[model samples]
Target: MKVLVFLLLIITTITSKGWAQDCLGMTLKAGTSYEMSTFNAKDKPTGKISYQVKDVHKEGSSTVMDITAQFEDEKGKQRTPYVIHYTCTGNELIADLSGMMQSMQATAMKDAEMKLKSNKLVYPGKLSVGQKLSDGQMEAEMVSNGNTMMNMNMVMSNRQVESKAPITTPAGTFDTYKIKSDMSFESRVMGIPIRNSMQVVSYRVDSQIFDIKSETYNKNGKLMGYTLLTKAN
Candidate 1:
């Protein structure tokens, strides 16, 4: 449903990161935290996502960061928190998509047996205008009491670095790369099939583990919602 779409959009926007290479200008540090506020099309506050860096270490040639993330509604009622990992190498940064399922587990698919498989999201160290990025995909199934409840599939494609820009948020002003991508979602609940698609425009700063801002739009280019970084430390 709509909740599922919003959760997927939140996951995509929050998972981008970087390191100390052309693609990354700095490394993730422990004890750092960031908060992003979500708003509806009318700019009404809806929910929030918070992240805390819990650990950072080296794994062979990669730097790995463990982060705890929590989602809360407008009223401050929080869902279950979960851990997600980000891996940074000299060439690019990658985010594990498996952890994203936890959001659904806390909402739409509560108490349902779930299975998920996904391709990690990648951000190349050297982003330039017009650079085409790799696509990402995810598929999941939920079952309960020996009956299939829902099956979902999502694809993010047409990714490209559109330009460099400065964006200002509650956290502060940041020099960022403006990236664009298209997303499609398909789900089957009971015997009915539902499909949705949207376009996302996100602004990310070098050396940061989160986006400065992200906007979602419907197929006709109407703004649907947006998320903005409100705090960082």
Candidate 2:
């Protein structure tokens, strides 16, 4: 269950800075689909997730896309469904933070109203060696069924572009920027403090606003799991 929480914290929709139109360059071709898989530290398959482009609308220089994400359980039954919007205008790509966290809050607390105080970074306009960008902060409070449940705050202080490389996977080869970030999370429940942090290495490609691959680690610096792009168009 803890693993699940760690994974959901980074369940990002897209990338960018300052409400800029930053995107993963993910093919906005309508009707195209991509499947990504999760693997444990040993490379054992654990779960599957998919994203599909539902619609695309061109509004002058910016393009708006409707995307649906589906998560399946071990038995292949869809357990989670979410929808988000992305705008590709300017030189960057941006995602609706409220929209991106809707599903996450729903999963975290049933029938709770959520307000996201932190913004998410999906992509930036540029990347270079040793360049670091602030990914921003996310804070939310959840009250479920009239009971005050919990509050969460996570901050991504900086993202450093480590290098550019060609990553080959089942989906194909993609030119990617390897970006690293340190994220800290804190929560309070019944006056008990829960704190943790993790290291993330995300492979972002010019072809998509979504990460081509993502790796996660625990605060102890142990590699816990990773995600791989299996199919994308």
Candidate 3:
């Protein structure tokens, strides 16, 4: 009888933890593709966009992601191409630039690690949107030169727009989350102070039992982009 009670307690704990995460971590291999659209200052359709396969990798907390992405300019010229190496620990995600990551100037990856370890903007409870039914919201910050650079709050709202049950695809099986977030950023690039606001709706798929998909929209309710993530297996 004592043994039975202990087993029941263990099961309960595991169940709770599993349901607590919207994007529970997974270890698998995958290929990802992304499309980016550029806009003009007047909010006019610039008719300029680019697409690429970011990378292929095994993804999880103990796993590191190898990423390569390319961006194009208004004239269809390649610009600001980057390769990134990153890992996710629970809800916290960190990335370090590959090859010559750290230079005379600090890299973005270094800043991400410091911010995570110090637990600055990490929401302590369940992540949700605009005063929903969850305990905690998603938070993020930027760090550079081992100093806090930017702070932001992420709140997810609305319901899953597609696929009610967890989805299973070639990428992997994952639970899906359709989230809308408000982003604010402050930075100094080339000695110029910059502040901007971004509103996004994302689909966070927990790639343990299904693939995740997110479609982003702008403040004017215009479709911005969509992301489809397939876990590497």
Candidate 4:
């Protein structure tokens, strides 16, 4: 989601009992560091983002990985730090918007209350090259100064594995799967209502936490922008 503006990723070094190369990318090795970069539609450098795996734990059916994310402007100035949680289903990664967004708002806003209700996207184990997957809806609200300042609802559907190919980035080259999805966003920010649709593309490296590259396209199919996993270890 919106917090992904900096970077979108799933982190863990542990592999589920029955899951391996096909379903999830990146077995999270805790204490490791990784970095990603963001770019505008014009291909201009936007910002730099980095993350470190803080901890990993097994909680019943879910494997919980904690990550600390740091942001920097194009000037390389540091931004506030954010702590995010990525939960795995013994097999594949699941996108939990509430944890993602709450961590984002907590770092970016002071005294802001953010609430997110979401349906998650499940990435399957033994990923098939042409498989289609569906994620769910997320509704988020931000309250400040005793008033509702922002409300957003996003629906992700029509999701699928579009293709598989070798991808090269500054971090390294990867045998990656290209995942695609359609998203609709309706929101009211500062009392301004906005509606938009987007096309999402992610190139995920086998067993990696985050995609090597991610793109967002507008309704007209014009490039809205993209982000990339530029570095990792």
- Which residue pairs overlap in candidate 1's backbone? 23-125
- Poorest lDDT segment (10 consecutive residues) of candidate 1: 14-23
Candidate 3 per-residue lDDT, tens place, 1-233, comes to 22111111111001121222223344423343434333333444332222232333444433444545444444666534444444545555443422112210132444353232221112212333333322123233456667665443333333223223454444556554554455443344334555544454444443422114434444576654443443332
Instruction: Please report the candidate that would top TM-score against the real structure.
Output: 1
Instruction: Give the per-residue lDDT digits (tens) of candidate 4, residues 1-233.
Output: 34444323221113333332222545655676788777889999878778887776677866777778777878988766767666777577775555556555766565879877664656665466789886767788888988998887777788788788888889888888988888777778798988777788888754776667888887789876777888787
In Å, residue 183's CA in model 2 sits off its true spot by 0.8
> How many residue pairs of model 4 clash at the backbone?
8
Alpha-carbon runs more than 4 Å astray in model 4: 1-26, 103-109, 145-147, 190-192
Which candidate do you rate higher for lDDT, 2 or 3? 2
Best by lDDT: 1
C-alpha lDDT of all candidate models, in order: 0.79, 0.69, 0.36, 0.69
Better of 1 and 4 by lDDT: 1
Give per-residue lDDT, candidate 4, residue 162: 78
lDDT of 2 by residue, 159-215 (tens): 889998888889988888998888787887655778888888888865675678888
Judged by whole-model lDDT over C-alpha atoms, candidate 3 comes out at 0.36
